[model samples]
Target: MNETPQKSQELKKVAECLYRNGNKVYFALVKVRGKQIKRSLKTDDMAIAKRRLAELREKAERLHGKENKNIRFEELAENWMESIKASLKPKSHDRRRVAIVGLTPFFKGMPVKAVGFAEIDEWRRKRGASISARSHNIELETLKNLLRYACDRGILMDNRAEDFKRRKQPKAVVDVLTRPQFQVLVKALYASPIAVASGAAAMVEFLAYSGMRVGEAREVRFCDVNFETNTILITSGESGTKNHEERTIPLFPNLRNLIQRIKAARPTADANDRIFQIDSPRGALPAACKRAGLPHFSVHSLRHFFASNAIENDVNFKVVAGWLGHSDGGMLVAKTYGHLRQEFSATMAQKMTFEGLSDTPPTFAVVRDAAA
Candidate 1:
């Protein structure tokens, strides 16, 4: 039964200094430094509620005379950002900083301990109106992490932000190119009058063949290639890969041939010289797609094409994930390309049939005659 506002606000004593509201959610109502403090345990489970209530009481007693209780949300957030800055990549740090900046206005002057579900809900309602769900979720996560940090430091009793659910995000559609479509695109790129078309064509082919991200491809040098071992070392500039580790992918046949062709054109090129001169094929790619009479394919589309082709060719997901610099032991690969694998499986299934099912099946006439 739904409780009226008056009934829901009424607290029933459950145990010493612990109470359950009409809705059955437990709360801690305790006194600290001669002042009454009320905090929700944020759970209905009896055991969990009791434990959280005990923890809350202990925190109040321990921080009775401390100045940590007075720390503002802005100060806590700044401290959290500073603590994480050294551990995160520059781009990642910047993203988190942006999230915190978006959150600062609503939470600025409030004490860490004073912020609760109402404040968080209000922030979510206001923010959801202006930004995409994905962006709001990022800021929401940042808020939760900041509160978690405050809890660890005893500046706040519990992370109230955890109780709020994140907004739903739209599923991403994976778009890739078939071999014929890719071939036509490359051909059009090569035939284009644009001066950078040739280089752009080379970049497209390199990404599709090597599964290297645009960033990683930009940093590849001729010296990184080992023709003897048929491997190409992928070092994405000083920052390394997205995961900050260098990986070596097999010098695939097409990739090797592409390199050799480029090498032939520039015999005097230094070993340190990068294979592709252009930073990105953005302009060239769209132009080539238009010329080829195909839909526009981004640089990332080439990466997806590589993964789709690998799955179609029966390459193991773990190996593909390794080549793509994923550390999750193929879980991400399976999630993204499992449908492609299913389509490939369906195609392969058509080749299987009972030998006797054919209209011109081989007869056992000799054996039957002998038996007769």
Candidate 2:
């Protein structure tokens, strides 16, 4: 009889701890040290509410007799951004700052610890609907990093955002210009009436011949190029290369001649002066492409053209990767230009013959008849 009564009292207290609000959402209300605490479990299901109630109760008991500093998500985000500011480049930092701005509105007043799968999923469904998968994934990555930061500092026991997977992105295609097409485009640029067409033409040739990024190309000074060693030293100003390290690339014949010609034109130019006068050929490049009846190509397309041309010409991927400032030892180059290699191999395969076989290769009709 006494056992039944004690169980009844316990069940009643448990029932009182959890209740449904006007919106049919379950909320956990409990008393800690004579002060009442209430939190929305953010669910309508009774089973989930009960489980969350137990977690809330345990957390409340642990935090008892201590100052409850419920830090807002925005506050923690700011701290995390500040902590990483010194380690990232300005553009990188700005991108993360933009991600934070997108995240803050959804989680403004929510406590860092209170954010869980439900809140995260809700935010994802709402946010992912409006943005591209790549953009959404960036924001999601930033959110996960912030939660992990909070966990490291003991603000939360776990990073609930850790298990959330990112959306799949589509495969990207690399477009490049053929040698003849590039020559025509350059000629068109030179023939254009634009005041900057001459400088833009030179810049276009420099990018395609040297395989340097626009940013890195803009920072190349005359002193950085060594005609004696037949090499060009790539050291983008204060920030360095994309990998933050300087590298040396062989000055190929075309690149060497282009630099020499430019130098000859500016006979009194100082070694400290930049190699290219213009930063980019954005305007001239597109107009030239249109005038030539060719596809519009950006500065990056020229870099691709360099890599494609090199691979097709039998320049090894590792060497090309070094010239392009990729830290990965030829992996990216091989992946991007593998198709070209295949085509090259197929062309070379046609010339091969067995010692006992006829030197003449089988024609398509002969192969078709044999197959039949």
Candidate 3:
């Protein structure tokens, strides 16, 4: 056993211990044949420097996936966010920022893969009544999308978010104002400031008359209207559309006149300029409502009003769907507005009641038959 020390046969000393900034560190350089290939296993660990280099060599030989061990979740998320930021629109990017900030606290130290259903449930439970169910769902969906991005890049093992379920939304009826109610609201808007009523009088009138979405109505420029054809083109916008496709909607004669009047009143009206140029709908809409002495009806109510009026007037559901720029005619007209359609059916039933009674033949009297 003592004879083994006779030949400490020229160990290659491939790995070396080094000191930098007074911290013990390890690095190894390996050269093979004429290639002079080099590999560095840089670590803060001095004792394990040689061992770390060997592991790296084995990993390289296997040629599996890259080893970014000790990578932080924040790092992967940051990397994924670059492309996402570029892809998202300005408003969308801002919304995503809020969602991310709300979600990050729950999973700060955890690996992306470790964020599964159990963690989501725990987070939701702890959140309690602070956030609405719909808001909670939005934040949850944002997390899911991030996980999906990681999975696509092979950075995550699985999208654990898929296992989580959304909270059920209560079936509250969406708000809609009747025609007379909306007229009262508009009167209140008339007394409000430009900041309070910025283009809303026109917006409400337009959406109610033309059945256009708020986003679509806001994007129309003066040039988009054709006086000769009497058509309004909802093709141009700063952001993409709800349906992501443009459509030419017939301008209701009344709506066209209202828009014209609004344009005439505006100091800055250009052929190519945004028709409704204001900071935000939120600024003016509420003030206008207060001044008009009317309830603050969201502009989206105009959409609901349009649907109700359409059903009442017996306008075909498909026609209403197209005017609203919905891809699914059935969903837009039938599903959400089925109750309105029932009112139409009720009107028809009234018409047939008297007619059915009159159309029936009178029965012969039993007394007359007994006398015979």
Candidate 4:
């Protein structure tokens, strides 16, 4: 016989603890006072049951620390994740959630205070074998932040995850498409009926011309582009810009034409409509590469292509940096694109000459003083 959840005695709703009791009511099966208890929500309405579930879970979590000071790592991680999930971007929140999921298998029942550098080091060494240093570092950082949060709340005396060493990663080489290769890609895009109709060619040219990331490009709306000024506003999206700052890039002639073509095709599109309806630009790029018979390049390569061309053309580094939405003015641009500038310098180097220096000594070098 299922009894209704009492409205009195502070018996409240919560998460992770409810079930349907046949067709009559929802049952709350939760741990209270270290013992599992089953109570009826007495409502078949899912919304009411869910509201009660959240309340129950929150109440239980609040009492967990007071009931037992030595909480398991998994339990503490769940509590910590809930506390900070709202503050993180969706992608970032998903990453941290995954890190927590990966963590529980190793530290599931370990007491928070018992976890230390040795355990973290072992996890790092084991995890590093399967993933890149960057990913490994992120996992370790996630664990470190969780433990740091626990420390701040007085749940633990120290943050042992902090002592785990991060792997040093080398800077990756920026792969860019040469002018001839880019031209080949464009030709291939136009040649293929499917590619041309899909608008992949226009996207490639847009990225190459504007230096915007594929994500940023995809987020751009019709209203974001200003034909009169020849500029496009890059705004934050679901994951936000890399640095979380919006910027505008000048609409170079090629890019401007591409946008114009798109607008002409969709004259009825509202200003709020996304310029490109394609879901993933990179997924569509490989076909063009296969047809072009050139090495497959990611969409990001087009950004590098833009930067390389800008540097080769002697565009001011700061201007290029701003166009690329980099906050460091041109420092990172100089480091990454400086070699192209050097290539230009090398060409100029060949043209240099000391006008006064010659194999033959100056005509009057042997100053025969007639007076002497």
Q: What's the TM-score of each model vs. the native? A: 0.79, 0.75, 0.70, 0.73
Candidate 2 regions off by >4 Å?
Answer: 1-68, 193-198, 353-372
Model 1, runs deviating above 4 Å: 1-71, 193-198, 355-372
- Candidate 2 whole-model C-alpha lDDT, 0 to 1: 0.85
What RMSD does each model have against the real structure? 5.9, 9.1, 14.3, 17.6
81-165 in candidate 2: lDDT tens per residue? Answer: 9999988888888999999998888899998879988999999999999989988999999999998887767576557888799
Q: What lDDT does model 3 reach?
A: 0.69
lDDT of 3 by residue, 99-135 (tens): 7778778777776656667887787787636898888
> Candidate 4: minimum summed lDDT over ten consecutive residues — where?
1-10
Encode model 1's per-residue lDDT on 149-268: one tens digit a residue.
887776776688999888888867788799999989888888876724348878888999999999999899999999999999999878678998999999999999999998998899
State the lDDT at 161 in candidate 4. 77
Model 4 Cα lDDT, one tens digit per residue, 1-372: 234443333333334676764354677777755857565666878799888767665544544356446888888898988898777767788899988887777788898867888887788777779988888888888898988877666565457777667889877787779999999998988787776677777788888888998878888999999989888899956667877888888889988888889899999999999988775467668988987799989988998999999988889899999999899989999988787898889998998988867778656568788999
Best by lDDT: 1
Off by over 4 Å in 4: 1-68, 237-239, 353-372
Ranking by TM-score: 1, 2, 4, 3
